[model samples]
Each structure stands twice: as C-alpha cells, then as structure tokens.
Target: MSARPSPIFRNVSSKVGIIAAFTALNLATDYMLTGLPNVKFMDAFYFIATFEFGLSVGLPVVCFTRTAYAIVNPLGAAPGFLIVFLVVGDSMYVLSGYLSRTFRLVEKESSAGDRVLSIGLIGLFSALGFDLITNFGTGLSMVGGSGLQSHLWGALVFGLITMNFPLPLGIVHEASDFLFFSTLVPSSLALLSRSGLITTGPLGRVIGKRGDNQN
Candidate 1:
C-alpha cells in the first residue's frame, strides 16, 4: 500500500481546505446578502482569514476569492476591473489584521470590553483603509493614460465621487464589520486552534499554542 502522507503534508492539506471553505462561505454569504443594505460579510471574513491564516496565506486567499467571485459573480461583474479593486480593498483588511498581530496591537486574551474596544479600533481603521484602496483603484483605472500629476488629481477626485454612493452605506458596513469581528473572531480562532488546523507565527501569534507555519 502507498504510505500515508506525512503529518506535515496532511496538516498543510487541511489548512488549504479550511482556507477554501472559508473563502467559499464568505462568497456565499455575500451572495445571500446581495439585496441587503450594506450587509455583506466581506471585511469581517477577511479579518477571520487573516486571524486564522496570517498574511502569507490570508492575502493570497483574499486575492483568489475576490477574483473567483468576480468571475462567477451573479449580479454581473461590471467595470471589468471590479475584481481587482475589491481584492485591493480586501487586502487592506488582511494587512490590518496582520499588523495587529505583528504589533500585539489587539489583546490576545482580555476582558470583553477591552477586546471589543481593541477590535473595534482595528475594524474602524480597516474600513477606512478598504475604502481608500478600492476607491483609489477605481480612480486609477479611470485615468490610466494621464500624466502623474493628473493621475494623482484624478484619483483623488474619483475616489471621493466613488465614496459618495449612498454615503451612509459606508458607515453601516463598518459597523457591521466591527460587530461581527468582535463577536466571532476570538471564538473562531480558539475553535480552529483546538482542531490543529491553524498555527501561530513569529511576528503574529495566533493560538500561540500548537504548530507554526508550514512554509
């Protein structure tokens, strides 16, 4: 009989599976909330991925999920570069999550108030960052052939115009991200940690219990 794959291989396989599952679920949730008022889970899900998987895995998965979702997106993927812009926005969430871990910016284990406050701060900044990245991408795409100064001016102009969509919608989305992240992230990390599917990293201590990165 063929020898079973080594424990390391099995572990890596499982992590990939978890990543794929989470990505699918995130997209599914977005689809379900399609008609809701800024009720999508994209930012919150990215926080979970980065919290569970870190930058190396989380960032690539964000890129993949955004691109895949865009390709097969049901509501029609208009503006062709929407996927790229969304990926850029999702990357902000991943980077924000990783930065928290890297700086020990968020509490690992603390009071509910403290944890909520810390995560809220992260979510707030992440929302703003997401808006900036995606809006900036949208802006750049519109002025691709312009000179550097014009490009800069165009980006700023378009970014604001883009952000004006149902202005309060942005606030609602940020609030949703904070609520979900505060309530779900720590618990998910613990459950996945118990399952031995995720690992801690040097700069970012996730679980900080069992395994480290396979790569």
Candidate 2:
C-alpha cells in the first residue's frame, strides 16, 4: 500500500513557519536600514515579499505586517496614518507584483529587443503607480488637497531615481533576497509550483526567459 501523506502537511505548518521567519528577517532588515534616513525599509520588504510569494500571498502579508507594526510603533501622531500607510503601501506592492508578472510574461514571448523595452516599461509604470498612490494618500492625510501636486511630483522624481532605475545596489539587494530565501525555503518554492501559484506555462517560461520553452 502507498504511504499516506503526513498529517503535519495538512496544517501548512512548515509554510507558515517559513513565512514567519522571513517576516522577522524583513522586520530586522527594516530596522537596521531605518537609520539611513533615505532608505525605506518597508518599501524594500514589500518588494521582497511580493517577489518571493507573488501578489496573492504577499499583499495580505504586507497589510497585516504593516498593521502590526503600526500597533507596536504608534508613531505618536494620528492613528489614521497607520491605516493609510498599510493600505497604500500594500496596494502599491500588489500592483508592482502584478505589473512585474505581466511585463515579464510579455517579454518572455517577445524578441530580444523587446525584452529590454518590456523591462523599461514595467519599471516605469510600476514606479509611477507606486508614487502616485503613495503620495496621494500621504498628501491627503498630511497636507490635504493642496499638497497633492507637490507631493506627487517629488515622489515621482524620487521613485523614478531610486526604485525604477536598475541601480546596482537595489539589484544586488533583490538578487540577494531571491537567493537567500529561495535556498532557505526550497519547500515553499516547491509548494508554490505545485499549487500553481508559480505557474508552469508559456507565460512562466517567458517570464524567466530561459529559452527552453518547455515551461
């Protein structure tokens, strides 16, 4: 007789443990980087989460994490800020993941020249989308309607430079994150593939652009 699957697997205990560990790592990294004044650790963690888990998983995680962080920190200001931050930032992260997946799929099927263009378009749109949503929410909360234009412009410029561009440091950070967690949570990765959260199709192949075309 074939052996039954382990009961432990039914609870998703291992997957939850891995996510929690990674969440802690993300928080630690944010704390360490918070001293930089310019670096936004939440944003970085948001990106990392989306890249690792995809939007379906990452966005809810981000929302809950941000809510928990706000409850702990309290910031000594309005409580509304916490809500705004969690909602806007989580939405932005989800949008980024969606755009990243879409553009990657497009690029995978395109010619070599289109790959570069696709990436550029994806980066530009992702950054712009993040900037618009984040700044709009921030301005609404902090400065009311009057501040929207200035805040939008400032955020657009900063996001374009810092997040959209293929900065060497950012690339290194993302690559490191991909490598580190992928190694540590190989089972999670396997589960994702099995669950179809990570697709195995023409889209997935094109997204990776491995040229194997076997999905």
Candidate 3:
C-alpha cells in the first residue's frame, strides 16, 4: 500500500485559508501604518507565519500579502519593477524564518536575553540585505534607460546610502525591523506556543519547551 501524503499537503483548502488569513492581516497592518514612513508589521507577520506553519505555507503567504499590499497601497499601485523589487526584498524574512525553524536558531532552551539577541540579529541582517537588494533594483530601474553605464555603481550607492542624506529611509527601515523582530516576533511566538498553535513536530525544531537535542 502507498503511504499517505504528509498532512501539510493533505488539506489544500486549509492551507489556502491560512494563507488568505495571513495576507489579510498583513494588508490591514500595512494600511493602518500607512503614515509611518518605513515602519510596518508585514515583515513580522511573514516571519511569524513561517515560524508557525513552516516554509511551505510561508512562501505563498509572503507573495500574496506583498502583492496585494502593493496593488492596494494607499499611495498608489507600485510600478511593475518596483513591485518586483519589493517582493524580492521582502522574501528575506521568509528565508530567515525558514532557516530559524530548520536550524533552531531561536533556541527554546536559551535564555531570554540570548534568544532576543539572536532574533534581533536575524532581523538586522535580513533588513540590511533586503534594503541592499531593493536599492540596487531601484537604481537599475532609474538608470536602465539613461545609458549611464559608468554611473551604475554610483546609482546603486545612491539608493543604498545617500538618497535621503540626513536620515536615510533604509536606516529607518532597518531600525524598525530590528526592533520589531526583537520584540514582536518572539512575543508572538510565545503566545502562539502557549495557545498550542506552534507545537513540536518532525518537520523541524520550533521555539518551545523542547530542546533541539531531544528531537
């Protein structure tokens, strides 16, 4: 007899429902925080979803949530290139989340301070990487039709560092991500764990009472 398919793939509709729900939550937070220049909970949501449901669910959730937010943005729909850049940039969180789960980066047995630091560092690196990539994309878009071959690197640097000189948007974005990841992500995970939404499983390690060595 053939073995049964994994539970994750067994109920397609439930996964869809979960993805839709996360997308809605992300969009709602984005709308509510529209006034905040670079601060938003969408990234945190992506991380949280990945933490809870694993990468299989997190990937679609990030794509749908980001695309919908871009289309329904309060300012306006993003340009096609910008939309692509944003999606690619935001995917850092998804990758970090998956890595954290797979490798037990946030150890359940670790002290609170250590866990917080680990999570914060993850956020910091992910945010920095996201900014670097998207900024390069933006720079390329700006200079692509200008035939400025010699200025490509300068344009990329402009996007990353000196675009807004005094207080760069990238700085604010990175700071907010670090703060949110340090505080919000762990707190939410603990709440979910307590609520039994995140439990020990064979797919990978999770942030709960069990140690990695146990599994």
Best by lDDT: 3
Estimate, for each residue in 148-184, the C-alpha lDDT of model 2 and write its tens digit. 6776666555544554355443444344334433233
TM-score winner between 2 and 3, please give it.
Answer: 3
Q: Give lDDT tens digits, candidate 3, residues 119-185.
A: 8888888888888877777777665444566568766875766535666777788789889999999
Assess candidate 2 and give its lDDT: 0.47
Model 3 lDDT-worst window of ten: 1-10
| Arranged by TM-score, best first | 3, 1, 2
TM-score of every prediction relative to native: 0.77, 0.48, 0.81
TM-score of 2: 0.48
Query: Comparing candidate 1 with candidate 3, which one achieves the higher TM-score?
Result: 3
Q: Compose the digit string of candidate 1's lDDT tens values, residues 1-215.
A: 22211122224655677578778888888788878756667677787777656675677679777887777767776466767778878887898777665555665636777977778667777887777777787788776644798897888678867675647666776777777777777677667667754334453333322554444
**Best candidate, TM-score:** 3
Specify the poorest-scoring 10-residue window by lDDT in model 2.
Answer: 1-10
Compute the lDDT of residue 199 as modeled in candidate 2.
30
lDDT of each: 0.69, 0.47, 0.76
Q: What's the true lDDT of residue 199 in model 1?
A: 38
Q: How much is the lDDT of residue 101 in candidate 1?
A: 59
